[model samples]
Target: MKVTKDIGVWTGTWLLLWSTLAYIDFFGIGGISLDTYFFILSFIVVFITCYLIAKAFYRTPLQKTNIVNYKFIKILFVIVTCIYIPILYKSLVLMTNGNIWEYRAKAFGSNDEASILFGNQNLRILYTIFIEGGVYFIQFAFLSLYLLTGKKSYLFKGFVLIFVMSIVMLGRSPIYYYALLVIFTIIYRSNGKLSLKVPILASILACVLFFLSAYRAGGEITLSYFIDKYIVGYHLYGFSLFEKSGGANSFFATSSWFGQATLGSFSYLLLYPFSKILSINFLYFNSQEYLLKNSFIVLNNGDEANAFYTIFYDMYQDFSWGAPLIYGSIFGIVYGIVYKKAMLRKDLNSFMLMLFFLNVTFGMIFRNPLATNGFVGFFFYFLLYILFNKIMKKRLHV
Candidate 1:
């Protein structure tokens, strides 16, 4: 793939954006009080290693797959839409009348408790489909098809789904993720040709994000306040935590009693699904305790210092001083190989998988996406793709 389309470049770009802001401490609250020379060195080592490995694998031959049937996709879209509409309707009816942000807050128990989406046990079975499955992936599939087939209907469906989901979910991150996927799809479709619209869309996305955040904060917070508390707060808090603990002070290291009985924070991403499947809470670990305990901040009415602790903090908490080397190297290898297959070979299935993996990569500036129920969502995405591919192959053979 072209350097511009590389996943490592994409990850590095986002990491730098937030990290730079944190380092500058633009609000001058001493965001990062400790020296980060070694931390930064660790990141640099990972970045270079990952990029080189990805480039080296560019020569790998592309894998072949049967073309997906648009007819089947249209039927599948109808089915998924049917499955989700009632859920959205019930959620809207249950939520407060005026506030939009309350939807996400309620669903995930971020700031509030009356979650109409996730709180109900009967309705929780479809959480995976609601989160990263049918809703968002359908939009991605239609958008990709629109680009390839020049089908306006596909484009229209994509936008309609995006609009409804954004309004219903009221999540700024999902919107940003969709925007990133759009940009990536365009770049891949155009064979690495950089479009002028990319910058334009980014500017628009930035504005939308700011306004949404301000609205969520009750419209009393200013842009500077939002950026400082959120955009910059993640790394600032992360670095500060590292400094205070003297390295490796996460619950994993400290909570031996809990760790002996249950999995640690690092295992949360990997073991979450089985926990959900078997109804075994012990198999899964929740990072909310860690995030709340570690990332407290008082700014503009005070909160849990922004939910984004940055991947570095999570790594350091788990691996202490070795976080940089371990996480950086692992991420590098995974991203490098995935970029080689998805972006370079232009495999749509691989691209879809790449997009799913992006929940971790793009979210590195924030907390691990897998910290919550994201691992189950990723599993569903992969499972659905495999099943759909089989159906497509069978149809082609018939």
Candidate 2:
């Protein structure tokens, strides 16, 4: 409706940025030796897919008023706070053979790689349920509700909630989510005319935070070190570094569990929230295929690491070598439709959906698609939205 950018536009742009980095990293970037034809080809496919999505669907955010029941938001906030505050307190109070920081570092840190795999699975699972589980629930819901309410008090409370969640898992994702929400909200308040400087600065700060978190366990902290480690998020060197490891071509040349990865993950979303509530593992939606591949990725690298691959790698797990091109185009079509429908309707639900998609997109290919992980979060918000909408007696002013 206006001459400006929107969420989908920004998301598609992110795709382009990551893909470009992939190309530079895969090829000889400033005399680096990580060049590979397959890597470049993978990035090409992703860039083109992003182009298609942008061309076909990106639009300015619809300028409209959205009304929600203040009562509903308050109740939602109270419920979220009651659940998480206690967990945060427990994480601070209890100890699993040591403090919270040591627990996290050993369980998942590079310093003690096998900590999670070896530590008391029962205690670890409990820690995950209480502390980490609340990240998505309270953070997004509280912040989104605050954005809807536009109250300074609500905003401050939302920040506190995020702080509590970060105490447990202050990894890249919680930080990224917080930054994106703040930036997106700021851009929204600016009527879609936000200067590029704000986001650019925010990005630098986020990266610094990411690097600082990684180095908090006592290691080198420098610009060059950050660039060498976390800033280079993807495994661009890939399995090709190992002699017997299968390269990208070898991956596609062989068969894989296509549906079990793609549709199976989609199916797994249905039960994930329940399993979390029941204190049971979600089994990554029962797709052991990723686990098997993760082992290979570790072997190929000769390290003790989880097989958290890039988006292309996840798609490969689903559809083999064709993952980068055809599957990416498919995502373009799917997300394009979501973008079109949501923008036309001024639907916050749709906006949240795309935000989660971008979350995983920029998040790299370490976990299940956002459609599953983020969808579960969105599904809860959707229920809340419906309840609020039905209870409202009259339309409220923004």
Candidate 3:
């Protein structure tokens, strides 16, 4: 069942999914207006065009190594769980005794609010690194093991950890992330083969998300409610950003747009985990001011909140007209190169690294995954894998 290593199809499909969803405006939150349609269509064309061009230059990786050692991975998993279990217990206690919903609200409310949720900044930092970051790395590794060995246990173990972490955090994004990773791993395992089961699995995950959202709200939520609030609301919020900012004209005319378009966003994307302590002023951009002013989530209860502007929302804010042509093309080229090494050459490390890029790709409907701390986790784990390979190779003289 070997298949073509064509990531363009995968990337294009996700783009179409979100764009089509935006077009449908299913619950009539806000249909894609003419300007939004033009922007969406243009971005898709540029992204796919650049992806195809880079894909044309594909070459097989020169060095493929057998990095998935069962014994080593088993030991690593045991060690990570041991380190995490105590922290997990503490988080569970906090969720039960504390105003967990308020905590969740704070986590999403603002950076200042989120920074102090765990009683002190240090504990919050530890919680983010070991729990939020750790779960992703562990699940990614376990899923990789599952693909290599065809053992369902590894997949189950990863899901359990992610599930617990999601509950403790009182959020649904982790579940979405794990589900996306599962889809990616399965596709890679099947040599790019796809089946009807993919959509079925996605539907099942959507159901799970619906339930999780209801649980978080402490009430029964309807399908239409979930669709309008959770699903359609984010895209609508994104559209509002485009409209409020005056679309592409904001790039040249707006001073605030300069902050979003600068290298500051990339610095935040890659080094967010360290930026708090480092205090590098030049690398930081206060796009938060623009987001707060432009993107506000209208709650069902008539309250307003923020966050979850669509993937291109930030890019559009940053580069406007150049978002698709420049940022889109850059992403397409990089992704095309990685897909070749990971899928075609069967390079384990590259395959794992590709998962992070895949996260960014799939997250086009949501926000940029690279802008989250999970990218730090993925990069950290990728390095760990490389280090382990070197140590193992030295020991085995491979």
TM-score of 1: 0.75
Model 2: worst 10 consecutive residues (lDDT sum): 27-36
Model 1 accuracy (lDDT, Cα): 0.58
Best by lDDT: 3
**Per-residue alpha-carbon lDDT of candidate 1 for residues 265-292, written as tens digits (9 for 90 to 100):** 3365456677789987654134433645
- Which residue pairs in model 2 clash with each other? none
- Candidate 1 residue spans exceeding 4 A from truth: 1-3, 33-37, 57-59, 69-76, 94-105, 109-114, 117-122, 128-131, 143-156, 203-211, 214-295, 299-304, 372-375
Q: Which 10 consecutive positions of candidate 3 have the poorest summed lDDT? A: 256-265
Give Cα distance to truth, residue 85, candidate 1, Å.
2.5
Sum up the clashes in candidate 3. Answer: 0
Query: What TM-score does each of the candidates earn?
Result: 0.75, 0.66, 0.82
CA lDDT for candidate 2: 0.51
For candidate 2, the per-residue lDDT at 129 reads 40
| Tens digit per residue, CA lDDT, model 3, 246-266 | 554443434335333333334
CA RMSD for every model? 5.0, 6.8, 4.0
Ranking by TM-score: 3, 1, 2
The sequence of per-residue lDDT tens digits that candidate 2 reaches over residues 289-368 is: 44454463333223333444444444555566666666656666666666565456545555555455555554443444
